[model samples]
Target chain A: MKTKLFAVPYIIWMALFVCIPIVLIVVYAFTNDAGAFTFENFKGMTSYASVFGRSFLLAAIATIICILIGYPLSIVMSKFPSNWQKIFTMLIMLPMWMNFLLRTYAWMSILEKTGLISQLLGLVGLPPLDIINTNTAVVIGMVYNFLPFMVLPIYSVVTKIDRSLIEAAQDLGATPGKVFKKVTLPLSLPGVLSGITMVFVPAVSTFVISQLLGGGKHMLLGDLIEMQFLGTAYNPHLGSAIALVMMIIVIICLRIMNRFGDGEGQAVIL
Target chain B: MKNMKKIIALLLAVCCVGAVMAGCGSGSSAGTNGEVTVCNWGEYIDEDVLDQFEEETGIKVNYTYFNSNETLYSTLNTGGASYDVIIPSDYMISRLIDEGMLEQLDFANIPNYALIDDQYKGLEYDPDELYSVPYMGGTVGIIYNTTMIEDEITGWSALFDPRYEGDILMFDNPRDALGIALLYLGYSLNTESEAELNEAYALLEQQKPLVQAYVMDQIFDKLESGEAAIGPYYAGDYLTMIENNPDLAFVVPEEGTNQFVDAMCIPKGSENKANAEAFINFMCETDVCLANMDMIGYTSANAEACEIYAQELDEEAAAIMFPSEEVINRCEVFKNLSPEALAMYDALWTKLKSGA
Candidate 1:
């Protein structure tokens, strides 16, 4: 009876949000270049492999950058005092509460020529840096926006660890670095895995930040999917095909993370 | 599990019933008599035109705005949108008509089609004048700050000049970006040859480092603030931006740019066709079109509005509303390309945008 109740909510939720859209996307993906139902849209994807390849490569680079930056920040956030941590946590989340478009717009204001940053740089006699629309700017925006999601999960697992274990390592003649390496790290592996999953997955689909801050320069997987919906792809079905592939890639990433991701340095190294 | 299964079945039944009701509501999209929802770009319309249309027709008018064409396309295409009339650019309008997304315009309702110029008629996409009515027309050009630069920045090459590295902005659009590259190569904006595309892509990659920002609406703000010295934008939008900032100046680049016309169309599935048509006819009125021109600062297609342009705006300012044939000839209107060509352009654009 409980299993049936669980199934009820799950089915309703999926029906309302996920399954319906997926069905629409699948039908559309098989549509012709003119957007009528046909098989040509799928065939179009192969002839344009570089688009998919470039999208995949950009997503991978963004994912790797997120992991590299997120891991340390999450680990540090996990070690903060409870009351202070809660305040710090909200401070981290404050930026996200602002509209995503607004945040990216804010970056443009800061990065543009004669922008506040550039003016300030000129005042100090350093030459202006044109960061807007660059891949580097896109990566910076990703790290800024997604760092909090990475921090929370690691913090959750770190808070649950028994501090006595770290003390035990210290009492047994372990250094502070050794205690973290052997004791706290192994225990916090679950949180790290969760954090990595949270950061990497969402970062792959980040379109607005890249569009706004990347100066229309970077075409990530998210932007490609958007092109289909906007009729720029010349075929709705092709857009659907691209989106379906992107979804599959995301699922694969999740599965891989579940299989081998760990916070423990030993498990991570192995 | 048996008890829960019954509850689950009941929930599914309830949801299905709700969906069926919603389906029926959507099916009655052609309105007999109800409100007509009009969605357009923010600050792009004359509010009085909307008011006068509502006043004359007695069809309740609900208006909303989008900041970009992509946003407009996505919102209208969402199908749940209640918009009876939408304004999209030439390319987007062509794309919609190609997809059978636009409703056939009944000429009996909009007899004022004669108000449209002969030159505007018989364009490639709406050749038979079946679906769309031209609203406002303009071309993309360079808007700049005269105070910032000493050189007369006459061509696309001026944009790439590194001396203005932090001062240069570009339109944050693949079409505009790609078109500029193609034009610089003395090719058509619709070129799709692999070699030409690769050449354009390479140029875009090189130019990326020089752009301070890829801006759309904010390009106006950036220009006003002196955040950027020059960027590509529609001539009508540039007119308004210059109005607000007297220091700003705009010109058609010596090489060329794309001319565009935004048109009004009714969607096939709108529930309020009567109200939609009434609103379209109302907008066609000389007074209404003039009011729309006043609010939007764009050149209205209504000949009457063009005649009244001087009365509404001083001669110097009104002159910007109309461009000479020499200026028109310097630019080309974007044509609907074949699917293969579109895909090739998209592919090159993708690599240019992503690879860098």
Candidate 2:
């Protein structure tokens, strides 16, 4: 009875913030400006499928790049003494403390045609990089901003990994590479799946990073929804409709990942 | 253990309630006997003038800001705040009037209304001069880097010229972007016809490949740093940009441009209507208006204020900021678009950004 009572506050918090807002979005999704129920909102998504496809493609690319970079980094850090590991982890996490918008703006100045990186390259007799307003810059921004999210989860799981299992594999006739692939790879599936989800979800929904870095030429799903509500478009019902589609897509992605990981992704959470 | 759980639950509930209360805390007491709340654009008014208004009038001024006119409209629509005064652009003023959301101003309380120039008065949005008091006015023009281009920039043609490809910055907002296209094609800025809008859309689509980026306030850094060579920006912003980059120049394109006026009015829900009028009256005083124009770098709507500062104002700066009467005559103000027209803009803008 006491344990059941303890869950009340959390249930209330979830209901107020998460569940209620989703309910409102769903409600607005099916209604028109005149408050009449309609299916036109859902039908309108067909015209914007290209926008959804582009955002998903860019976000997937960013997530894949983050995994490639962050997995090795966390693995190397896991080999350090636990005390030094904490210091190195803090160094990685320090940039996350600053506002993400300011960080993206800093990237803007560093990547511009005549900005710092270009000046440094010119000094080294190398060509200037002209990627500030390009899709590549946006992907770089997504990976940079969400890399820590990928690292922290995978690091926690890798550090908590049992040490005796590696010794056990070594005792057998298995070579170092075969033992590691057979043992380490299977065990870390949960962490990698969760890391992919962690990076993918926010990257797909982000508007600010793309707006500041992508130079407003690229219209992602997030920017489309924002324009409907706040920009000159001024249609909350349409905005909510787009929000519903985005939520559905994200939830579907999460479910597929969960199924593939055999529901172990949930357990990997710290 | 049960008692401990109960105590923890109580602590959590108390914390939630405290947070809710803190968020609901009022910035100032509601306008009742002697208080007045004025909501305007962020950084639109000089803070010193606000202090002087409080000194001259005994009423307490509660000032707040909104970044865009849409935000102001939504706040009022939701009844989220009861603002005694609001400063909105000309098109928004039309929307507010159409909805009967504004209070009809009593000119008796604002005798300083005589200071307004004849040109700023009786605009299409408020033809009767019964609602809005013109605060500041400006037109849209181009700001370019003098060192980058040798040829003279005559008009909107410069924005689309092939030589400046990948070196031009365009406005990100749909209204301004479409407005520029319409002006370039010699159509009314407020065109509601689908054919005309499509023409504007085609022009923008053709120019999309050449644009360095679509930007808003980012123009400041881009132009000053020479990151982009030419940009279409408000005439007033040119003054602020040139102070940092002496290589910059502003032009009021010979083809014509957009002239906009942001004005002050009281919403219908205002409680202290009289006090709001007094605040508007205070804003029109020659010294008060002059100080505001100096800080903001926009042209003054008050004739007396302009005359008083005429000697001190730089001649070249004045010409760029406020063009001659011939140029002003050629400019048109934006009107509120109907729902169908707005939807057309949204669809076209999405297609433009998607490159499909």
Candidate 3:
């Protein structure tokens, strides 16, 4: 009874911040500016199908790049001595402590025509890197900012795997590679799934990255929704509808990934 | 022991609820004469002016900022905050008036209203001269790195010139970007016609390949560092930029451009109307306006204050910063669009951005 009583504050907080906002979004999504019931918001969203496609495509590419870089780094970090692992983990998290906007702005300077990279390349008699206002810069920003989310989860899970189980596989005349693949890989599935969710969700929904690095040349789902509310468009009904659709799509994507990861990933999703 | 733990848990929950209620209570109860909330553009005013206003009036100021007029509109439309005084552009003032969101100024309280230039008063946005007191005014023009582009830039066509391909920056917002395109095509900036707007859209689409990026405040960094060759931005900001990079030059294109005026107004339901009026009156004083002009590098709307500011500039600088009557004649102010027009702009802007 006391434990249940202790949860009252948390329940109130969740109701006020989380549950209420979601209900309001759903209500606004189905209504027009005059508060009349309407499906026009959704009907008009077909025009923005290209933005939806671009956002998901870029986010998926960023997520894949993060996994490619992070999975091996996490494995290597897990193999380090315990104290060394702690230092490496700290290094991975150090960049995140700074403001996210400041880090993105730093990349803007680094990727510009006369920026640090270009100057160094010039010193070597190479052409300047001209990728500042392109889709490539946005992808680089997503990978740089969200890479730690991918690394830390996999590292923690890989570190916590039972050492005795791996030794047991080794004793059964199994080669080192086979024992590691069959034992280590299966145990880390939950971590990898969670990491993908962490990286992909924020990457798809990020407006700042696309605006600052992508040069506002392309509209992503985040930019489209922002335009309706705060940009010149000023239509909250459409903004709410777009947000609802994006949320539904993201939820569907996570559901499929969870099923593919099997029952172990269910615990992480919750 | 369990009874003691229950008592502790009950106290913790009570404290949490009590704290939230306390926070909510404090914000809405500040309707007294000692406090006035003011919302203006980010980095728009000199901080010293705010401090001086507070010192002179003995009315504590709760200052806030919004980046764009649309953000300010949404903030008020949603009742997000209760601001006593708001400074917004001319078109937005007209929209707010149409929505009955603004209060008419008591000019008797603001005696300094007489100091505003006659040209700045009774304009289209506030035809009756009842609501707003003009604060700052400027024209949109091209700023270029003279070293990078040796060709003389005399008009908006320079933005589309392939000679400066991969070196041009354009406005990020739909209104300004489309407005420039309309001006380039010899259409009125405030045209409500669909065909005219579509023509503007096509011009912008054609120019997209030449543009290095679409930017707003970032134009400062890009132009000052010589990373971009040419772009269109406010003339006042060009003045600020040329100080950083001597290679920079500004021109009010031969084809006319936007002449924007930001004014101060009190929103309806203001808690301290008299205090807000006093603050606006204080801002109109010559010394105060001159101080702000110096800090922000924008042209002052106060006639005497503008003269004093122009005296400090040399002949060429003065001519560029304060264009002669001939150039001013060609410029047009933006008017508030109807709901249909605004929606069309939003749709067209989305299409342009998505590369559709």
Candidate 4:
């Protein structure tokens, strides 16, 4: 009775969204591009391969940058008083208040040829650059928008760490740097992992940031999936197959993280 | 165990809620008695007309807007909304009629049908005027800023010219962007030949680096801000932009451009057929059309409306909106292509948009 009660809602939801959509996608992958029940759609991995490469590569880069920037900022904020911490945290998540589309259009207005920054640069002796369509612009948009995701998780964990441990490390003849390298860093790993997970998942699947801010030139996996569903691609079967594969990849990453996550279960932190 | 059960139940409930929302996404049920829905592009029509339409006819016209033609096509294609009336461009109407998705209108009820021009009747998509009624007509052309790039730019060659690098804006659509290239190559806009399409793709590839943005609907705004020097836009939109910035001028290239007519059609699934026909007749009514024409700033096909509208419009503005004999003859109407040909065009268009 207990198991049934626990399982019923999940089964219902899984049947409706996850299980059904995935079944459809898989069915489509094997079907013809014209949506006929043929094996042609799954015969080639060209679209899937290209999208997978692009999605993973872009996401990995964004995740790395988030870690590099988020880790240090979080450490700095963890030292602040409780009242100041709340204020800083609110400031971090404030960008969330603005609609994503509005924020994206704001980037377009600011990045255009006659945009605010370009005009400001004109007042100096420099010429204006078309930064809107470039890969650098894509990275800039993704990083700025997603940085808070990376910060909050790390901050929440770092703030919860007791200060006395670091004091004890210093008392035991360890340098300030050594204490951080040993204690502060290890303790914040879970938060960093969660932060990385949060940023990594959406960053990999993001289309708007790359398409709109990147001048619709970049062919990331998310955009490619969007194209299959809406744009000229129109191959939902292939899109579904590739998306299922992506979900599998995320699942595998989580499993690997779980294996190494518990420091108490291991002899070495690494 | 109870806690685990609760967690699973919660996740499942969230999923169920999400599924229901997706299922309900197409709830455009305006087909109820005495109610009709108007599906159009964002800011494409006037709202005051709806209130007046409801007041005059006692037919409630619920308005919905889409940002792109493709978005509208998806909804209509999926029967997402049981919309009574839809306004689609020439090529799409031909496809829809061919696909048996549209209802054939009974002309006897639409007495205001006489208001439409004789030339608009023989359009390639609805040659017999059996399936649809002409709403608004306009040509695609170059909208440019004289201050930004002061050159006598004519034809598609001006678009690819390296001198206008980064100052150029291109249409966000594949058909318009690729059509200009096809025209530059002296090929048909609806070219079936892959060789010709490859040439269009090659030319587009060259122009890609020079373009600042690939946009539609937003081009006029971008032009107004002096951000882009040249863009291929609807001639009517260019005129509207000119109203704000006097320096903005529009011209149809000598090689020619697309002359499009947006037409009103009632779909087969429309429940309120009677009310839908009534609304169409009301829109075609002589004085009612004039108001719609003046509000939208497009050439009204309603000849009776134009008879009153012409005296109100100055000669130059009137000529631009309501085309003369030579203008009508020069305009090229888009024809529906075969599925294979469409696939070819779509692929090339993607490469063009993808900036390859």
- Candidate number of the best TM-score: 3
lDDT of 2 at A265: 51
Over the stretch A178-245, how does candidate 2's per-residue lDDT look in tens digits? 87688776677777888888899889989988788999998998899888877765888889999888
Per-model lDDT: 0.75, 0.88, 0.91, 0.77
Q: Tens-digit lDDT track for model 3 on A1-270?
A: 999999999999999998999999999999998899999889977788899999999999999999999999998999999999999999999999999999998898899898889999999999999899899999999999999999999899999999999999999877989987889888888889889988999999898888888888988888888899987668999999999999888888888878777677542432
Q: Clash number for model 1? A: 8
| Higher-scoring candidate on lDDT, 1 or 2 | 2
| DockQ in order | 0.40, 0.58, 0.62, 0.30
Candidate 2 whole-model C-alpha lDDT, 0 to 1: 0.88
Clashing pairs in 2: none
Q: Candidate 1, residues A1-270: lDDT per residue as tens digits?
A: 989988998899989898898998888877764566676666655644654565555656765666677667766776777788788788888888898778877887887666788899999999877676677777777777777777777777777889898788889999989998888777877776666666666677778876777766656677777776663554466778888777776677666766664434221211
Off by over 4 Å in 4: A1-15, A33-36, A43-55, A162-173, A241-270, B1-33, B353-356
Q: Write the per-residue lDDT of candidate 3 for residues B1-356, one digit (tens) a residue.
A: 99999999999999999999999788546433477889998878888987788777777788899999999999999999999999999999999999899999999999999999998999999999899999999999999999999988999999999989999999998899999999999999998899999999999999999988899998999899888999999988888898899899999999999999999999998988999999999999999999998888888889999899899988867887688999999899999999889988888899999984
RMSD of each: 6.6, 3.9, 3.8, 5.8
* List of chain B TM-scores, one per candidate: 0.86, 0.90, 0.91, 0.88
Best by lDDT: 3
Q: Judged by TM-score relative to the true structure, which candidate is superior, 3 or 4?
A: 3
Clashing pairs in 1: A1-B1, A133-A214, A133-A215, B29-B270, B29-B271, B30-B271, B31-B271, B31-B272
- lDDT tens digits, residue span B1-356, model 2: 99999999999999999988877665344333488899988778899887677677767788999978887887888689999999999999998999899999999999999988898999999999999999999998989999997787879989988899999999988999998999899998999999999999999999998999999888999999999999999877888898999999988888788999999999999998999999998888888898888888888899888777666768988786667889898899989888789889899999899774
Q: What DockQ number belongs to candidate 2?
A: 0.58
lDDT of 1 by residue, B1-356 (tens): 99899999999999999999999777545333468888887777767666566556656677888766666766766665767899887877787888788998887888888787676777766888898888888878778899998778788787878888767888666677889988888888877677887888788788877777666787877898887788888777877787678888777887888888888899778887767777777777787777777777777888777887767667656656787788788878777666677767776666666554
Better of 2 and 3 by TM-score: 3
- Stretches of model 1 off by over 4 angstroms after superposition: A20-82, A164-175, A248-270, B1-33, B47-56, B64-82, B111-124, B155-168, B172-174, B181-215, B243-245, B312-315, B329-331
State residue B150's C-alpha deviation in candidate 4, in Å. 2.0
Model 3's interface RMSD = 1.3
- Per-residue lDDT, model 4, residue A174, is 95
